[model samples]
Target: MVRIAYDPTPYHFNHGVLELPDIVARLGYEYMQLTPHPEFGPFHRMPKADDELVAALKKRAADAGVKIVALQPVQRISWPEEPQREAAVRNFKRVIEITAQLGVDTINTEFSGRPERSEDSEAGFYRSMEELIPVAEKEGVRINIDPHPDDFVEDGLEAWRVIRGLNSKQVGFVYVGSHSFHMGNQAATLLPQVGDRLGAVFAADTYDHHRSNGLRYITNPPGNSVRVHQHQEIGNGDVDWNELFDTLGKIGYLDREDAVIVSNVFGENEDAEGSALRQLDKIRELISGAAR
Candidate 1:
């Protein structure tokens, strides 16, 4: 059976960990992919949370019957300089430890560009991977690097190359269709290879060319730009879902099972919760139809 998962980034402002499972369960998604933005707010970070607290959170979700597909930790390990870079690495390790305690195997993150020379940036990337890879292995977790348009590694090809260079099975790609569409309309050609390094998939929409940088840019209020133009819902954009879904299926995505997809619905702070629910409902319908 295909497992459907939701990324909580869309409605994160309106909800918290405590209320997430219920909302997710209510929407009919089997798994919930938590986008743990450390700086987002107090409720989402849980930095000082111990095993007992972590277990409680997991128990709450389980009690609600919403499994954790993965934890998407953004900017958890992205830094421009060495000192800040080290700090980012430490934060990332903490997140890995949390995932380990929570019984989650996938930790999704990104590598922001280094403002150094090209060769220096390449060197820093490998160095960063080497630094972070062992923590993932030690924790028995897969490090998912989802490509963002503004990041150093934004497209499928570069991500593949980085993973190959790292040469560890612990690293994989979280194929974000919006970024793929904006960076290059290559998800179709990339899907086959995507399966090979597949860690997760974030189902989102974007325009033909604007700010599809994987960072949702809410030109509206709440001032979040991780992804561009949070739009109202899926299938309301120019992204070719049919072909993308078909290609994903061919690559063994299996509708909602092979990967976890999250919807990035843009809206004002007051309308956030409704937008997320709306996106979730629409996606459930879309995936259901696609599966058929």
Candidate 2:
């Protein structure tokens, strides 16, 4: 069975971390992918969590009957600078320690490669992984890295290569539906290419830009240079949900013991709770249909 998880990215800005479990459970979701928060350092660049905070968060989730299946620590580890890179590695080590304490086994993140210096960034990524991989193994945690649009290793094939290079079962790839355009055109083909390294997935939709010729939509001047995409409700965008689910079934993702299918829709909408519940229903229906 494919365990469907709800990610609280939309609520990260408005809701307190302690309140997430209740919201997730109320939406009828059994699992959650905890995002970074200012109070808990968002688990991004070294959380502000000590033993007390970690214990509190874990207890809160347990009390609400929501299992924290994964934690997303959004940090830039591909910095070419030496000191900053070392600090990122250290921060990730702390994140892994927190993951172990919370009894969660997975950490999802972007490769976060530097756009300007691709080669240096790739080297930096490998160097950081060398230090962090052993720590992950020791703590019994899996690292699932994805190919974000502007990251150095943005290509799906390249991301898989990096995961394979790590040469550890604890490392794997995440297929973000919101990044399908940037990942590649053939979702059916690309997904299976990751093969057994496919550990988790970010279930959301994005506006298709394959035919736009780079003239799709403009955010604003002076915005972050990276190309951004939406994490809208599944059927609201161009992601082929039927095809995605069918492909997943063909790959036996639903049967994998460690597979995580997360509903990660984020926007400035008012009814986040309603939106999440709706997405959960859609995901469940698709998974069930695929099984049949």
Candidate 3:
């Protein structure tokens, strides 16, 4: 009962494209995670997009029968300078508002960053959440902070700090298995701690040796010497996805509302797309087999 989704970034898809909804639908994903155009810094802080454009996008998604699950931010905002940080928070607030209007309930961002070793890194997380949580509560959308590889709070333990620091139901975490695999944490043990507070999980392939080495590629895939975190299609990486899915199931995530496990496919070539879709199909079949 685990639902699957695609990040749609590397595939040259975004909100601006009028064809995105149809593309997502045709890809057979149940949820679409929207990202801000790179030029706009991922959150698209232009206040409101053209109403006509919004209407058209909404209509297309409706026609395609896909749900827009969460609004994702551009990566830069995660570890911005102090001066730029406030504006990033403001922009994130606006993104949540936009999602709320669209009837979506989650705002996903790279805001869970680790600042340069300072007194504020720990306090800053709480301070930032205090400002945003009220806005999220008001807008009726939850905030999901993604734990990126190099960012502050990149691993599950650090992510737990922010999640526990905020102590607000409105704030949650997005656990990317690649992130966990990169950190070499036991996914089964870490997942239950986050549980439903896990707004979403990015299920992609990661090479254990590569992820362990901070994503550096000393060797290439199939080369027998590569150890970098190459974002491979699912079923091709070192992670035991069946065990990962079982862990998710044990946490009562099966068929839960907004339970989205998306694949953040790195390469955008046609081969990558085929590989991604194939991975999803395999995952769907695996989950079904597990249920039976």
lDDT of candidate 1 over 1-292, digit per residue (tens): 3555766665565566667788778766768877653332232233555677678778989999988867766542445467656666666777788888888888776666542343455566677778888988999999878666656656578667776777788898777766655457787787687565776766667666544463333454555434443343566567777777667667666644446666655443365556566766766666665623
lDDT tens digits, residues 1-292, model 3?
5567767766554335566677777777877877665432344244445555556766777888988877776533443356556666676666666677677887777654553532355555556666778888988998777766555555676666667677788878777766655455667787788877878877777767644554444444445522246566776667787787787777877568668777776754557557667867876865665421
Task: Tally clashes: model 1.
Answer: 13
Error of 3 at 201 (Å): 1.2
| Clash total of candidate 3 | 5
Task: Give the local distance difference test score of model 2.
Answer: 0.85
lDDT, residue 87, candidate 2: 81
List pairs with backbone clashes in candidate 2: 36-42, 37-42
Q: lDDT of each structure?
A: 0.66, 0.85, 0.66
Best candidate (score: TM-score): 2
lDDT of 2 by residue, 145-192 (tens): 988888887778767887788778888999999998887747688878
What ranges in model 3 sit over 4 Å off?
A: 13-16, 39-51, 75-80, 210-216, 219-228, 290-292
Give lDDT: candidate 1, residue 45: 36
> Could you tell me every candidate's TM-score relative to the true structure?
0.81, 0.94, 0.84
